[model samples]
Target: MQDFNGQIAFITGGASGAGLGQAQVFGRAGARIVIADVRAEAIETALAALAGEGITAHGIVLDIMDREAYARAADEVEQVFGAPPTLLFNTAGVNSFGPVEKTTYADFDWIVGVNLGGVINGMVTFVPRMIAAGKPGHIVTVSSMGGLQGSAIAAPYSAAKAAVVNLMESYRAGLAQYGIGVSVVCPANIKTNIAEASRLRPAQFAGSGYVENEASIASLHSIHAHGMEPIELAEHVKAAIEQNQLYVIPYPEAKEQLRRHYDEIVDAVLPMEADPEGARKRTEALRNWAADRARVFQKSEG
Candidate 1:
């Protein structure tokens, strides 16, 4: 892990933005970069940029939500690079802004599938093989500041990213026994095209009065316009990797929010009382609601 020279890095969503920035850093550190992206043209552009910088990199068209595609990408990376990649960066994600009541099930599915499920798929498809090879490796899953603390208007995004943060934490604990390192990044806001690159709602959801129209999208763009640069966030990621840190938060403001979130949770916890079954039932009901919605979406898609 200390040495990255000649190592291989497999990065999802590496066509542009933060993912591509991370690729550039890894490439500069002498690692062979395997960049997977859903956008064909963007991947080509990224590859060209890396080549111009004298970095070793290859691009593959990938949809991280597709398990078969993920597996095939891993195989292809090994075939082209002659070894399993030592680094896996699960950085693909999308953003949607609206009240939970106005967010359609499709929106939730797409966000959760790409943001959280994608990271799970990457870990499942890559981590075991890395362990099997008995080589030093690292996995970095990109969450967000919203992952640490809920956002008022981005419920689906917050839920999905929070899942990623927890998943990476669990993976870190388990992987430590196997000599693999794991890092989770919680970026507050970065200048990324995620809002623009997001897929449009299907007609069903578009007409359901739950989709974010042009105005909302534009508002989100305005916020991103004021966010940090991808390169600066990439620097934090690289530093975390070098230091073997488990959590990487690039924004100072985000650190304060995380502290506040923890304090709020502690404050909300009340002393145990008799007949707490009602509270437990309410929690279970919420869980079941989320699960039921997820199931309905999967069934419809299937």
Candidate 2:
């Protein structure tokens, strides 16, 4: 995973933003780029931009939610470029702002379908092929800082991103034995068209029931307006891949917050009062409850 030259990369949502930034970095490193996006025009535009940079690239129209389309895109890349792509980026995502109580079923479905399900689809379709090829490769899943911490206002986005973060962790642990590296990016804020480019809410959620309230939307917009450049975050991703790092955190300030949060958890665990009888009873009850819960939850999938 250290070297990318002459390798092939398949990037979802590569038409713009951080996805395009990753594509640019890979291309600059002499990698063959396959930019997949739902917007045909945007893909063409990205192709033109890459071409202008003298990069070898191709554009494939892809809606990551469509499993068939994802498979076909992977097949096409292999047919044209030889072996399966070595670098796979699951970067397509959307944002929803609002309170959890106001959120509707459709809102949850759309966000989860695009963010979490899309990442799952990409991994399923590409990881096995890469492992079979027996080549060094990396899977980069673009999660958000919101994924790391539950943001009160953006419940749907936070839920989806949290799922992505955990999924990447599981994927990394599972793939490590196969020599396939995985990196999960927890970006705090980066300048992108996420808000403007987000898909419209379904009619079922559009009126009042939508999770994103006006205040929260305004807050997100303000943050977006002041976010980092996409390329800067992309460089961080490239550096993480080069270093074989599992977590790629782009914002330094946000890292401090994360560190503080972890410290608080550690502190909370360290100050235990001596209470043998109470502790034993509590532990046994907790273990029993967990055992019961696991039996019921065993059949469910994340």
Please give the clash total of every predicted structure, in order. Answer: 0, 4
Residue-pair clash count for candidate 2: 4
61 Cα displacement, candidate 1 (Å): 0.6
- How does each model score on lDDT? 0.84, 0.84
True-vs-predicted CA distance for residue 233, candidate 1, Å: 0.9
TM-score of every candidate relative to the true structure: 0.85, 0.84
- Which stretches of model 2 miss by more than 4 angstroms? 199-208, 211-222, 268-302
Minimum summed lDDT over a 10-residue window in model 2 is located at 197-206
Q: Which digits, one per residue and each the tens of the lDDT, describe model 2 over residues 71-95? A: 9988999999999988999998888
Maximum-lDDT candidate: 2
RMSD of 1: 7.9
TM-score of 1: 0.85
For candidate 2, the per-residue lDDT at 141 reads 93
lDDT of 2: 0.84
| 1-302: candidate 1 lDDT, tens digit per residue | 77889989998989888999988888998999999988899999999999999999999998888899989998998899887889989998887776777776777777777788888899999987899889888888899888877766778789989989898889988798777899999888888887774454334434332445677667778888888888788888888888889999867765666788799899888755644887789889999998999899789969
- Residue clash pairs of candidate 2: 97-212, 98-211, 98-212, 98-213
True lDDT of residue 219, candidate 1:
71
